[model samples]
Target: MARSQKQKSVTPTPPSQLDRFDEANSARLGLICVQERIPEDYTRWDIEFLVDDRPSRLTCISPGEYGGVPHGLDGDFATILNVMYLEQGAPESGIVHTTAYQMLQRAGFPDSGQYYQSLQESLDRLKAATYTASESWRDHKRQRWTTVKFNIIERITAETQDGLGFGSGTTLKIQLARPVVESIREKYLKPLDMSFVLSLKRSLTRSLYRVLDAHRYQPSMTAEAAAEFRINLQQWARECKLRETVPARIKRNLESAHKELVERGYLTSVEYEGSRADTVIIYTFGDLPATTPAPEPVIEVVPDAPVTDALRRYGVAPTVARNLVSEFGESLVTQRLEKFEAMLKSGYQARKKSALLVDIIRDQGGKYADPEGYQVEPQRSEANLQAATVAKRMEAEEAQLNHRLQEEFRLLDHSEQAARALTQVRMFVGREVSERTLKTLLSAMTSEQVEPYEVYRAVTRAASELRLADFAHELRYAYGD
Candidate 1:
């Protein structure tokens, strides 16, 4: 017998070693609005941001779409910067081969269809919106500050499928605007602790972190120089495109984010000086912890054997079958079979049985649940059937909890909903399983012989676990004990 050689496993770059970057102009000017959502007719014009005690102006124009300017979830623009930096090196004109799924994964978003759709929407907004920097855009090569107009992303093309041009698996060709490319090529860039940024639980906090970091750090700065950052309350609010005007309201709005950053050790303290309209908010930077906190270990959920034994006959991938079992458990077969038999009795037919079965398993909205007329006998023995009753009761309780959460989520305003969703995405990214799976997929994506289907499987499995984890957190928060 001959021994076979084993391929070496690729190690991913640790979060601290990733060395991501942000464009200085965007950071200093706070070009993307921090609010999660804004009115479709919203607009910001000639907002003044101070640099070196000098007033620099910025104007954001959407010319199309909502919020009148780039706002909220548009923070994906920062992820765009990191991706471009990794692929293009010194940013020149070219198309980089990647997928929307990869982008979502890199940004700590769930690799699910809904998030993929959101990513596409954000990309369109970036391409359509224009920014005018007045004595604000930095021309490092010319060593001058100049006025410039540009889009964050120039163009995007994706391979089409089923009349849907952009999707998770679709290949993407994104071109960075020439001005953005020139800015980077000229070295007008700032190093960002991306892991720290993504670790933040709120978009407002992340935005504040970027803006403060820009003002605190200088190319020649020592530790003493970069220790503190201060800004006028009103000016800072305007720079962030805050929807509020009153100083008190602004402080109140920022309080939660301030508390979060402080607790996370990114800031030692956030202080305010003066009163009324003349207040100034001060930020004291804190030393980061020496190491990343290890994620809580994931307790693996083994799929029920009977569920897999039944699903495998439908030609489902083993991993997907496992996921379905983990999600639907003992009821996976009986419920769908009952519904399928009902559909047949009604003279309706599925073109393909396997396709219909898979669809039925995936649909959580009860699309194939017998329409209130049928029930199937349990396929298991009497003893096993009785044992499954507990699982069924737990499932029912989960459904009720989900309903309650959905109502709670619906009561929130648009901004709150967006903020909550963003936090969930970040939380998913911080999970050990998500991190491990992402590293493996990222390594494979860069290889010469990549397997697309395998990547999809990995993404699906990770996403399933992310959904479950997110639900568990929501449950604990909503109902203690």
Candidate 2:
């Protein structure tokens, strides 16, 4: 008798899920150069834009580095780095622990000496570069546009290096700048389709896709996606730091990218309107695979589940309730819901109560964090309890100090406020940062319309940048212990 044979089943490997970036960084002007083969001697790049009907500037400066500012391949390295950082859970320390080999692998680069050398050069460029954004950086958490200066990679510490200073075994601790770190922590991010992005053949196309994605899909829009985008040709050139401002030149440069994107189903078409400087470029979206990965299969919450019942009682849709419980877990959903209920009981009237409750859960904002029913540790030592109490007291004191400082600043006339902020900036951050801060303040104030909040925020932020401990000490001394 012949024996029966069975075939083994094999599951296909899924495409890599590696893409995300702070929307601000992706959209910032002149942060990443679109040009390939930038001269090593190039040191600065600047771009101007109209933000809220006001002129804004972004400047990139790199000094004392042979690589000058980041351009071309550096942008690819940056995307890979950001993806790795998010993949590691966006630790509060702002440090992403990774290896050069791992980064190359994620970027789909081969493990070879040539690629390793290229990675090292990119790291050097990133470390040396600094960006100054004048009223162009969007702080989504604060819901404002503000001035900021930061490096893409603040510092890098490698555990082991070969003769070339970076190797496959070299473990890296890459620290992001405070602004970038804060944006990630606050979830001011947008999805990137790394599979599609990396598949693009041209660096310019990849750069265009990243910048355009920011314009196409924003965090604030209620619509799930944006289908069209329009921009002036000259302004687009300047935004991308392209040397070509003439319409024909710009279009010629973009022609290949346009064709590539259209062929890849990322854009339906790229069309032009008018001519010369008045030319406008229009981009129509296509059915590219979603930038975000598909959600995991939903596990429906049982009718008897406490979280589901609680959500239902609040008039949440069944599908929404199940997703909330499945995505954030029942424990956190319950916690946030309880917090929302407490707010309602305290006379906090919400126009859309269900929506507000969902926001409270998803945002994890401070408004709903200090409510009753917070999770507490099961056991605590006497010393640990004392330490926790001290920490809470310190936090309260810091909050009070911040409120007092802002209040005092608000009380001053505009001129007085500017003078005070400049003094503090110079005292804490030295002459360079102070001069830049003053320049931004003067520029903004001299404009026909000025935003006091933006000016004050910039100065205060600069003061806390380089010498925060000293700044705090001075503030405490002036205001009293």
Winner by TM-score = 2
Question: Which candidate number maximizes lDDT?
Answer: 2
Model 1 Cα displacement at 218 (Å)?
4.3
Q: Give candidate 1 regions above 4 Å deviation.
A: 1-18, 50-55, 64-67, 218-225, 288-481
Residue 305, candidate 2: C-alpha displacement in angstroms: 31
Q: Pairing residues by index, what is the TM-score of model 1?
A: 0.55
lDDT of candidate 2 at residue 443, scale 0 to 100? 54
Which residue pairs of candidate 1 clash? none
Report lDDT (Cα) of residue 230, candidate 1: 78
Measured with C-alpha atoms, the lDDT of residue 379 in candidate 1 is 51
Q: For candidate 1, write residues 1-481 as lDDT tens digits.
A: 0111121122222223434556566676777777666776776555866544567778777864533677655675555644445333442343444566557655656656777776777778877778888777777766767888888877887764435745544557787766666655555656566656655656666666666666765432222225577778988888777878899999987787789777777678999999988899998767533233222211111223555656666666655666676666656555565576577677777787667777886787867546556655655424365366656865765565445445555664543444334333333333323434433434443452443333333333456666556543543343223
lDDT of each: 0.59, 0.65
